[model samples]
Target: MLRNIVEEHFDNDPDVTIAAAKQIRRMDRDYADVGDKLYALQIAKGNRLLDEDDLDGSWGQFDEAGALKPDAPEAPNGKRQVLLAKGWKEMERCYHACPDLAIDALEQIMQIDANFREARSKLYALYVSKADRLGRACDRDGAFPHLMRALEIYPEGGEAQQGLAVCTPTPIPTPPPAAPVQVPTVTPRVVLPTPPPPPPNSPTDISAAPNSPTDPPVVRANASSAAHPAEKSARTGCARAEQSARTGCPVTEDSWRTKLITLAA
Candidate 1:
């Protein structure tokens, strides 16, 4: 009954196991192993709690087991397992929401056991993830340390190498001076010759006077003298007028009247 209680009730009813062990020890000397059985029960309960991810409960069980038998290796080993499980749980829960907390938790796990279940890899991945997130947010300065730490963890990590490359500053090259602009030459304009003025007293230069008694006589050109005797007489009158104008002499009225009457006849 005591063996059954220790084996079955240790996980579900720890108080029942304790009561059974106490009663069995008082009743028979053959059951002198009750104290050792109780120690085993506590260690078993702690391991079960650890497997169920009940960190606080597992820690309490491991502490009670160690108090029961301080020289036992199982209790100390169980306590270490519980701490490792706690660190893993914290890291998983806060990796994205609170990366610093997650890093601290993983680091604690490293202190507990550097070889604990891929803790180094998990820590490296966390740093890389944090660096990537900050880089995406344009916080390169904030991301630098995390990227550097990730590279330290894994010197040959491709993602860490790429991230560091992105963070480094590159110098800009200076541009060459621009070529001078060319100005086009203009052509001179050609000058044309001016035409000569028409000659004075040309046949087209004739002008007529107004028909008035006080007005001077008008001379008209003869198209042809052979056209008629009248035309020949008219030409003679025009010749006499031109002769009077050249000498700057006034013609006698009687002479002009006689010449005009003859041309008219």
Candidate 2:
């Protein structure tokens, strides 16, 4: 009966402990009371050994040889043994920090020896509380991994599961798009009206006008009249005026008036 209780305590190996629990629960509830009492005594001793070892006080069971078996080793210590010591320290802190969680682990360990489990359950709970507190204080992703390993070591470990659930990450949210830019329009330049030309009989001369188109015709007439008086005597002066500007002297329109004044002087 004592052996059966040990098996249930290590329910981490579900298949084996489940089988053992099934068979043991069916036996006479009060039958082998002495064996039940002996199992309780053994668990107390085992819990003391764990306390001496400073192990995370989780529930465990014994093997066929009546020797207690614990879960797997925690993560390896770093080169300087820095990371490993940190993990151990954190687990210890967790066990001490949260009384409720520590109690849960200790109670589960003591389940096999109800009397022993109850007597030392508080201390066992402290161990678990220390481990959980350390994990949370570190605030690292590795904390979850350590907790997961504890669960794997003791598949029935409720405290480890709770730690894992809390340390899990949450998802991020997305945002919306921005507004468009506005541009200004520009206008073109405005042109002023051109003044009208002077009348043919006006005292105001047309040549002084800036960029006037009528200057070339007046200059051509003056040049032809001055150079071809004989052509005018024969009534052929109009044709000679056109030819004079083109061939006679190669004189420019500006020089025409000057040359005529010189001839008169």
Candidate 3:
């Protein structure tokens, strides 16, 4: 208890008990420091358990003494020399049935010292096995945690890296849907055959007013008789064109010819 308290609580006194423990184990190989005579009683109890084929109980007592007496080179039971042996034995006995129970036994060995012989490697392998099983079952969420634990112990392990990738999800790219085909719609143009443009004299044809067939002859005659030809022709020809238009009769070609002869004279 004192050793556990000192190692667990005080940061400075952790190794303080090592020297004293060594001396006690050297003189009293049975561990006089443990409490009255707990070590002796454990040995008796271990012998009785062994007689009953209780290998587990016997191993526990042996291991407890090993912890109490680290430096007892010649101590009958010895210090963890068989550290991995007992866990391996237990794992073998129950591994085919309940792997976790066997794994727990190995983990207890790890608590004593993680690097103890093959315990770390064995524990890491078990984690990989569990990871593979869960991943194969499509339980990635369950698999990843075990893979992470394995990596923590052996960061560069190939099995752990492979298992992690197996458990990881991959995204599939979906192609965009195909574009729909467009059909051409033809609207027939209702070409009401251009209603042959109204005659140039028609009152509705504003576009034809400048070149009215009836106004052009009068315009040419008025232009010849006046000095400011464009201004005078515009005023006189437009007035005659308006009168001819209102009377619904075109100007006589003879009237235009007469105007032209007067201008010449």
- lDDT, model 1, position 3: 74
How far out, in Å, is residue 18 in model 3? 23
Clashes (backbone N, CA, C under 3 Å), per candidate, total 0, 21, 0
As a TM-score, model 2 comes out at: 0.23
Best by lDDT: 1
Q: List per-prediction Cα lDDT, in the order shown.
A: 0.83, 0.48, 0.66
Error of 1 at 18 (Å): 3.2
TM-score for all models, in order of appearance: 0.51, 0.23, 0.39
Question: Whole-model lDDT, candidate 2?
Answer: 0.48
In model 2, the Cα lDDT at residue 253 comes to 49
Pick the winner on TM-score between candidates 2 and 3. 3
Best by TM-score: 1
The sequence of per-residue lDDT tens digits that candidate 3 reaches over residues 1-265 is: 5446534533334234434444445666665453323344445555555556566766676565545455543224422434455666787786668877877977887877787767788888888888888887988999999999999888989999988877775768899999998979999888776668767656785555566565544334544465576777777778779868998887665776787799999
Report the lDDT tens digits of candidate 2 across residue range 1-265: 6356545555345444434543553564444443343343434433443455534321332221132122312211111122222334443455656555544544444443434323343443354455676776876465665565566546676887778777775656666666666667768779889999876866584465555574454434566567766766555445446658778765444566677799999
Candidate 2 off by > 4 Å: 1-130, 133-146, 156-158, 171-265
Could you tell which candidate, 1 or 3, scores higher by TM-score? Answer: 1
lDDT of 3 at 2: 46
Model 3 clash pairs are none
